[model samples]
Each structure stands twice: as structure tokens, then as C-alpha cells.
Target: MQRYFVAPAQISGHTAVLEGDDARHLAQVMRARPGDKFIVCDGSGREALAKVVTVDKDIVRAEIVEERFAESEMAWRVTVAQSLPKGDKLETVIQKGTEAGAAVFLPFLSQRTVVQYDERKEAKRVERWRRIAKEAAEQSHRGVVPEVMAVSSWKSLIGRFAEYDLVLLCYEEEGRAGNGLRRVLTEFAAKQAEGGKPRILIVVGPEGGFDEREAEAAAAAGAKPIGLGKRILRTETAALYALACIAYASGELGGD
Candidate 1:
């Protein structure tokens, strides 16, 4: 069934009103009408089975049938702190990362980052990224859409380290040294099993990867420098690799 995410206010007393693009998609693209069944999420992790009652040009009203328990989300909340790569690579990361259960996408500037930051266009860019995340979340059957954060500087990114239970810095140097990601994730999994949900931050550098000084600074700030593997991965690939490993370790991938 198709899924639509709406604001909390859009749902009231067993009724859901999908407006804007979602409404158009349902009415025109899906050719939805009265009695059409679909899933509705409130963007706060709450989802319900809803049956369409009305379809208009810019609105689609539905009655909530029953609340649904979404097991699609990962038990561990993983945030991808990706350095801004050149071109449209960040879009790919946000789209695929959301499907893979990433909770948030944070783009930051690193020492070797080549893309120039344009304050004038930042809002538009961020908005586009968020849209990509929402669409991907809906398609992936996620109860909540992943947030796409505004770009931050390297210093700003490191300062937020305390916000996460575990911060994995994807450094190629560590990969060459044989410090693998699996061991760190295993430790994190054990901690999660003890009690309480833990938040993880996976930091990947720009196309050039992180400079030695940046890696050292991150490690000093409590971020664990871990390697994806012996083979080097592009900056965009690192976060996805780490997220997959995390999902597997947290049993989201059917692991014990």
C-alpha cells in the first residue's frame, strides 16, 4: 500500500487530510477515490491505516482505520554526518540513507572539502534534501521521515559530538591500520542490549576524505576513528557502509 506523511495537525478524530504534493499524488497519480486504502504517518513515528473518503484537486481526506506498529525503523538511531561532496552526491546519500533507516542527515564542511558554501542558496538546497528524504522514507515504508540538517562547519560538527552515544569517524587511515568497524559496532550493540536506545553518529569526510588533523581532532572530541575495511571507499559510500554494519549489529538485518 502507498504511504503518506502528514503533519500532526492534519490528523484529528480518526480523520487525515493530505494536502500539497501528497494530495495531488494521491488524487491524480494514484487515481485514488473513496474507499481507497493506504497508510498514513504523522511524521512523529505514528502511523495508521486510512481509507480515503474524499479526493479533490488539492486535498485527499481519509478516515483512520487503525493505528499501525512500524517495525521498519532501526532500533539504533543513526545520524549520517556527511561532508558536502561535489555535485549531486549528497542527494543520493540522503535518498538511499533514508531507505536504509538513517534517522538524520547532517552535511558539514571538512578541511579537504572542495565545494564552496553558498549562504544565499543554502535554504533551497536544504529544502531539496529534506524533500528527497521524505519521498524516500515514504517509499521505504518508514513511519518517520529523516531530517536533513543545514550544512555546518568542521568545528561546528565536532562540537556536536556529545549529542551522540557513539560517533564513528570514517577514516581511511584507520582502515589501513586494520581498525575495523565491526568491533566498534559490536561494542555498541552490547551497550544497547543493556538498556535504553542509543544514538549513533557516522561522520564521513568529503571527496578527499578527512585530513590527518581532522581525524585527530575528531578522536580527541570522543569520536571513535573506525575503518570500513582495507579497501578505500568514496566519502559518499562510507556512511552507507557504516549504517549497514550498524543495522546488522543492532539486529535490524535479522541478526541475533
Candidate 2:
């Protein structure tokens, strides 16, 4: 069934109201009418099977049929702190990362980051990234949409280290040294086995990658330096790669 996410307020009692783009998509693109059924999520992890009762150009109202759980989310909450890469690479990361079960995306500015920060366009850019995340979440049948946070400075990013249970710094130097992500994640899994769901932050640098000082600063902030493998990955590829491995390790990918 097609899935759509709406604000919690949009769902009341046994009714769901889908407005804006979703409404148009259903009314025009899907050619949905009364009795058409679909899944609707409240963006807060709550979802229900709904049957459309009415449809208009600006809105679509549906009656909730049954509340259901997809269990499509990962066991671990993974946040990707990605340095702003050039062009629309961040869009790719947000889209694919959401599908891979990333819980959040943090675009930060590293020392080697070449893209100039434009304060005037920051809000718009962040909004676009969030839209990408939402669409990807819906298409991937995710329980909740991944958050795309506003861009932050390197210092600001490091300061939030305490917010996560584990912070993995994707450093090529560590990759060359042969220390791998699997080993680090395995140790972390064992350590947190008895605890509740753990939150993980994977920090990936920009095109030029993190300089020695930036890597050292991240490590000092309790972020463990881990390698993706011997092979180097681009800035955009690192976060997605890390998310996939984490998902597979946590059994979200059907591993034993």
C-alpha cells in the first residue's frame, strides 16, 4: 500500500486528513477516490490503515481502518553528521540514508569543507533536505521520517557528542591503519547489550576529508575513530556505507 506521512494533528479519533502535496498526489497522481485504501503515518511513528472517504484538490480525508506496526525501523538510532559536500550530494545522502534507516542527518562545516556557507539560503536548503528525507521515508515504508538538521560548524557538531551513546568518526587514516567499523560496532553492541536502544552518530568529512586537527578534536570529544575499510570513500558515500553496515549489524538487514 502507498504510504503518506502527516502531522499528528491531522489525525483525530478515527479520521486522517492529508493536505498539501500529499492531497494533490492522491487526487491527481494516484487518481484515488472514496474507498481507496492506503497507509498513513503521523510522522511520530504512529501509523494506521486508512480508507479514503473524500478527496479534493487541496485535501483528502480518510477513515482509519486498523492501527498497524511496520517494524521497519532499525534497532539502533543512527545519525549521520555529514560535512557539507559540493553540489546536491547532501540530497543523495539524505534520500538514501533515510532508506537505510538513518534516524537523523546533521550537515556540518569542517575545516576542509569547500562549499561556502550562505546564511541567506540556509533555511531553504535545510527545508529541501527535510523534504527529501520525508519522501524517502514514505517510499521506504519507514515508521518515522528522518530529521535533517540545519548545518552546523565543526565546533558545534563536536559539542553535541554527549547526545549520542556512540560516535564513530569516519577517518581514512583509521582505514589505512586497518581498524574497521565492524570491530568497533561489535564492541559497542556487546557493551550496550543490556541497555535500551543505543543512539549512534557517524561523522563523515567533506571532499578534502578531515584534517588531522579536526579528527583529533572529534576523537577528544568521545568520538571513536573507525574505518569503513582499506578503500577510501567519497564524502557522500561514507555516511550511507556506515549506515548500511550498522543496520546489517543490528539485525535491521535480516542478519543473525
Candidate 3:
């Protein structure tokens, strides 16, 4: 089924109104008309089964036939805080991260990061990443569209560590720290077996990798360093790999 997202305000009573670019897509691109059925997601984890009742130049009215809980999101809410990578790599991160069940994306500048964003460029970057996330969510049949926040600095991201239950830092230095991702996940799983939701914050570094002092600072902030493997993965590849593993390990993805 075709899926579209709209604000909750657009869905009132039995009608779901499609406005702006969505309206144009339905009217022209999709060639939709009255009586055609489509699924409208309000980005709040709800899916409404609707059929078009009326179509106009700027708005399409859809009648809600049924409403149900959307597809399963994830047992754990993972937020990926990545140090900005070069060029189109950030776009790839946004798209794949959304598909991997990331609730939100934080693009930050680290000491070794090659990419820099000023206020003006930051606004444009956020806009671009948000669009990428939206389209990816739709393509993957995600119930909610993940958000892409404005660019931030590593120090600012570290300060927000208290908001999450567990913070995992992907680093090659985990061998020296006496802690690894497997151990961290094992402990977290033991806790979750009892009760409550798991909220994990994953921090991935840039192409040049994290500086030693920066890694220590993140550790002091309570983020455990975890090794990906012996082979070094690129900045963009690490976050997606981590999120995929997290989903599978958390039982969100079925296993034998």
C-alpha cells in the first residue's frame, strides 16, 4: 500500500487532508482520484487506512475507513550521534539510519572531523537530511519519520548523555578500556529481561577518527567504548552496522 505522512492536525473527525507537496504527488504523480485507497501516517506511530473522497488543486480529502497501530518500531529506541562525515556520506547516514530504527540523528563536529558547518550551512544541511530521512522512512514502511537535528559540537552532544539509559561509543580503543560492545549489550540485556524500555545512544566518529582526549571525555561522560571488529570501518558504515546489530540483538529483527 502507498503511504504518506501528514501532521496530526490534518487528521480530524473522519477526514485526512493532504496538502502541499503531498497533494501534488497524489493528484499528478500518483494519479490518484476519489475512491482510491491509501495509508496515511501521522508520524506519531499510527496508521490510518483511508480512501480519497475528494481531490482539488491543493488539497485531497481522504475518509478514514479504519485506524490501527502501525508496524512494530523497535524494542529499543536508538539515537545515532555521528560526527559529520564528508560530502554525500551524511545523506547515506540519514537514509540508512532511519531504516535501521533510529529515532533521531545528531550530526556533530568532532576534533578530527573534516566537515564544518556554520549556522547558514547548518540550516541547509538539516533540511536536506530531514528530507532524506522522510523519504527513507516511507520507502521502508516506517510508522514514524525519524528527525534530523541541526549540526552540533561534540561537547554539546556529550552534555546530553544523561538523557539516555545507555551510551555506546564505537571506538578502536575498547581493548584498553576493559569493556566492549558485546559486554555492554550483555549487561543491558540482563537488565531489560526484568522490565522497562531500553534507550541506547550510539556515538560514531568521523573519517579521521576520534582524538584520544575526546574519546576519554566521552568515556568520562559514561559512554562505554565498543570495538566494531579488527577491520576498521568507514565513518558512514559504522553507524549503520551498529544499528543493524542493535536491532537484531534486541529481538526486533527475528532470529533462529
Task: Give per-residue CA lDDT, model 1, range 10-54, as digits (tens).
Answer: 989889999989999999999998999999998888899999999
* Candidate 1 ranges beyond 4 A from true positions: none
Clashes of 1: 0
Q: Please tell me which model should have the higher lDDT, number 1 or number 3.
A: 1
**TM-score to true structure, per model:** 0.97, 0.97, 0.94
Tens digit of lDDT per residue, candidate 3, span 1-256?
7888899999898889999888888889899989999889999998899999999988999999999888758788899999989989989988988988899899889999886566777777789889899888888899999988888888899999999999988997773554556767767877785446678999999998889999899989998889876677899999898887787678776863
Displacement of the residue 240 alpha carbon in candidate 3, Å: 0.6
* Local distance difference test, each candidate: 0.91, 0.91, 0.87
